[model samples]
Target: MKLKNIVISAVAALTLGSTLAEVGVGSKATVDAASINSTAQTYSYVGTSYLYKILKAAGITYNKFYKDNKITYRKGKPEGIVVHETADSGATAYNEAIFFNREWSNISAYVHAFVDDKQVIQMMTTKYGVWGAGAIANKRFIQVELAEVSTRAKFAKSVNNDAIYIARLLHQWNLKPNDAHYDGSGTIWSHYAVSKYLGGTDHTDPVGYFSKWGYTFSQFYQLIKYYYNLQGATTNTSSASSSSSKTSSSSKASSSSKASSSSKASSSSKTSASSSTSSNSTQAAKATVVKKTLKHNAYIYTSTGKRTKTLKRAGTTFTVTGTKTIKGRKYYHVGSNKYVVASNIDGTLRTLKHNAYVYDTVGFRKGTTVLKKGKRVRTYGGRVKIGKKYYYQTSVSTFVKAGNF
Candidate 1:
């Protein structure tokens, strides 16, 4: 038998305010079935139940055929109904079904219901998971996805329907009105919080859309608190676990003592080894003068004596007239008396060539580095490289190879 649709005018009075009071703030409101029919547009069918008939009789057209069609029932009493807003329109049932199926993949398929300004659709049984909540545990939750329309009037109507639908679900399940976000500490969550648990961040429904309507997170929290109280359940608090503090403190102290004793033994051994190593190094080497080559600031220098001075900026060669040792390694004075060793040279600097005298360009690179004027290199940690020229690492630096600048 076909279902009858009830259409209440937009100006209908809200007679459920007292009932809302009983549910508490943030709690779901309970409206009598008769009141729902009188104040809201309700569709009835001869054979179908009130819930199924009301959805089928809504104004929107439903696509009778779609792929991935399955219905599952939930197992326990519902905790709350989570509302979701689909940015897409629901002109055809086929498209709606497909969208619902795709979103239900990460979780079990069990959305309690779907609604739009004109119609409400039931895809899965209210008894099981509907692949809703993404990574959130939906064992005792009802998920309702609303089809958003383009017009503001329709949008307002959709919101009202969503609110009413949620209230009805709460009444039926005798559940609390507190919705849980996946990341919610105690109980209450959003799809965004749930996705975080599954290592996903793509889904940001319900909360995102609701916020556009001036709904704040705190407001939602208050609603949950109100509902929890109405349901005769106390809100979860951090101090609830304080009874076990003694055990936790005892365990912590025991672990700390063991760690402290082990650390002391290791510290004593390191101290003795460091003293012996320092003495051996002093006796190992005799003072010897040797000649060495040093490069500084992009200039090559030859030391004839033990004198440190800035090399003359004569092309790429700096002539050092000081007597020095060629023993281990020597640094060359480049430009203005700046002594720099060859070993200190960064190989990633394309401008610095072997045996070629180089000069420091700028203190740092600015902006981004473009390669071949096409590919852009990312600047991170104050370093940047462009073509054959290497820039210094600075606050204005763009990008450079590690240990190359």
Candidate 2:
């Protein structure tokens, strides 16, 4: 029985050794597989109420076959990065992944990183394929999900962070601008764009969020272009020192010079344009008409469309005789009442109904002839006959009758 146990242990050790040898020391097997597996499993369902701190601290069980580890190829090369913004506020990575897997049947493209204000969570390996870029699924691309509430400030910050992250990632990947999702033939497209291409016609994502931050799709493309230009310039300079061949040196130098010049021109142009745009934006903001409110005592017409009297209390109502516009807005004139501009009214003013008197906080007096149709009408302390009997102003306050003419 002792001999049997020793033999079994030796066989097991041999099998484990062969497996380790096959995976190699430099391979991902060096990391704890269980940890990675746990992370992969939990990534499918993060939500608003999720405690990120707990998840961060928990153990991850690593699975090499997970979306973060699997890479599928259509041709030979990987695609570019796809940018996305989750429309749901306070969404968690786990929930998003679960939704994608279940409802979308994992049919959707995969994202590599989930970014919020404070941290970037890596859900998948950059080398592997994740469902990030729609019908262009087979194309290798990194998808970054930005966590942000859809407000102007948060949107701006998210855009800035996205730009910085993408720029850095492209730099690391040695990708050209043309290789970016928005630039090349197999360029990166939004979920909406992909949905349209696939003939399903129901998807929009980065577009809406990017637009909220004042970036159009084309502008986003230009940003990628800018980064690519920077990367290309760096590469050209690095390669320039390696070759002793005169022809290669000359070509490299010429190309480098042109690229440098172009970069400078582009940078200057962008700076100037940004400045002009900001200036115009500021001017526009300043030019907006601010609403101002004014409080004063005025008699409102209630009944007897022609009579007007001084109102001393809140509920006093009198007849409004006419209407006029001052400073480009309309106001009602009670009999012998001073015209007050509608723009100066504090609260929402209802349309003045004929023969209706709204009580005023202010008081108006009778026999005061205020302007009406470029003229004036004298208001006796009582109801004055106008064009109609019912169309007269009535004083809600004490009224003194006018003397006989």
Candidate 3:
């Protein structure tokens, strides 16, 4: 019986060895299979997030930076950074800086820094917090706005600059890197997160903006972590480069060049020192008159560009009493002191191919209201990419698939 058991064991071992020899454990087929799986995992983000491409593109860009002394936070120090995206799709960081610097009081919004593909313009110091997210977030977070761009490479570069900037700020504040969680526990918070958990504002930015490029906040958090974990990556504010003095010089030169550009509107010389006083006298002189229907919900602002309490719905017709330019964009005067963006009126007509649902600017369904098939509608005259699809703006906070029309 023992000899028979030994004979069976030897036969089983020989069979296993024969099977291994036939398959060849380290054969070309096995190596190829492993290589394909690894490649699949590595390039999974190719068409979507561009994370793989960004990870290999460059180390860190030496961006143009500027600093200013502004109002300090109520807590004397910021606990984290709030990420924001400029609502305007075409505005650069310098362009945004010019507008915010000129109209912070009127708009009641200001951020510490604005980042674009080409530069990082620090409008104010991180030691101070600006009225960016809301009362609560403003007091606790250093706000930074990422300007939207047109191309993939540019977007990659812009985000690289943005992540590096966030990392540097976190390093400067001695705050550890953390992704914002449901409970509002983290050193990195998005404007959307702030609105969701800390509610002083209603803007859901960066999230929608990132979706347009197939990017997500999670990927951004990963990038932030990448920079934060580097050995000497974020040791100083001038960590954009090794030479602090050179960085300062370049920043000043870049800002001065922007100021000298004629394409940029001359920022309002009149400052709003007192909220009670208005800056209408410095506003653009009235030019033309026209009447049009609002294509999207329009916010009525004072003649001095201060947003008022009024919101006009789409499909409402109004007489544009006059026209004026603010920060180089046209505004239609609807009343003695009321104004709205001129583009908000004068929409492009379309006929619905199917029943359409209205979506918000961030691609969220506004309500149950649906436009029936064959119905004629007007769009805000441009297509906005929300997620991977294009939508036509029917109103502020309302959109429908462009294909549906």
Candidate 4:
């Protein structure tokens, strides 16, 4: 209820160059989800069902508690979940509930639930609008508060449970986790994001609070996407294996990954060619580009940018390859459908790390199974954030924990 507890300064620092237009509350941005990340899948999640149990035990129900407390509700289904953190340090879920219960102003701030390490207490129903995300977002989204924790382990537990709670909501809404990450239209947004993307209040909540422990929006969404994928009937490992990713490496990663690609190409032969083909089967045929410089030693990934083939040597002028684009960025597809940024090349070569692992996607999901580990996995580029952990997106979904590499 108190805006002073949260600050919006952090949002400005993070979105320094963003071109986001001011959108009023209840407005929806139209964009394709595939342009950012692949559509998610669903699988069994033990936490999904357990969150309900915790909510029940905490005596959180709309009719039994929320309506009784005189909280308001709108007559509609929620489109998404908006994440918030009580800037009140170490605030428990019960404390948040009690605060919400007593805030008797003419236009009081309210939300749907408050989550702690062991339990989720529902403060209101998602079917109706709550007063949490300003007048605009509160009119649409189901706002949830994350109670601050005292330690890293506690933070992880509390956040993981929040993921479960959010996953259940997404499933109930018949949407995917990554659906929220959709271009200009992702459903899962932070309080800061709410202000930036769905303008109203300028509160920079969860982000300001979470980043203190090295947590980031990138990592927070990863957990949501991971949990959302759990609601699927099957895994979508193959969905993102062919996509563009962070810029590639130049040194050892290139040659090692290239050699590994060659080995796979030779072994798979028929299958390799088909698999090597761009995810866009009907992509316009590209003219064979001859020996061009490896140039920047950029990462060579699958056409989709989901899987990294390896790093290309900077000075080594390998066969200049075909070109294509995933969303809008152009890429040169070399041997089979291996890819590198058209701009990330130079007439050069070198060696960096000796080896690494290959993964299926850039996220931290099970569908991102390790294709290869130890050796053979030549990664280019740097680390990516995923749910509070800074993991080197070694290749695709394969990541080495921050301290591992």
lDDT top scorer: 3
TM-score of each: 0.34, 0.37, 0.42, 0.44
Candidate 2 on 1-405: residue-level lDDT in tens? 001111111111112113212212233432323232222211111111122343445543332324343556555455556666666566644555334433332233345666553344555456666544444553556667666555554443344334445654565565654432232244444444443344222334555554444445455555445333322321111131110111110101011111110000110100011122321111111111122111212333322222234222212222333344322233434334343322112212122222222111011122344322322222212222211121111111111122211
CA lDDT of every candidate? 0.33, 0.34, 0.55, 0.49
Instruction: Return whichever of 1 and 4 wins on TM-score.
Output: 4
Say which prediction, candidate 3 or candidate 4, comes out ahead on TM-score. 4
Candidate 3 backbone overlaps, count:
2
Residues 1-405, candidate 1: write the lDDT tens digits.
000111121111112111212112232322222222222221111011223344366654433222354323344555555555554543432345444444444333435566665545566555555445543445545667666566545554444444444544454466555545433442345444444443222455554444344343334444334222322211121232101111110000011111110100111100011111331121112222222211112223333223343221101222222211133333323333333332212111232112221111111222243233222222111122322343322111112332332
Predict model 3's lDDT versus the native: 0.55
- Selected candidate, larger TM-score, 2 vs 3: 3
Point to the candidate with the largest TM-score.
4
How much is the lDDT of residue 292 in candidate 1? Answer: 23
Question: Could you tell me the TM-score of candidate 1?
Answer: 0.34
List the candidate 1 regions with Cα displacement exceeding 4 Å.
1-75, 89-110, 135-140, 179-188, 197-201, 213-405
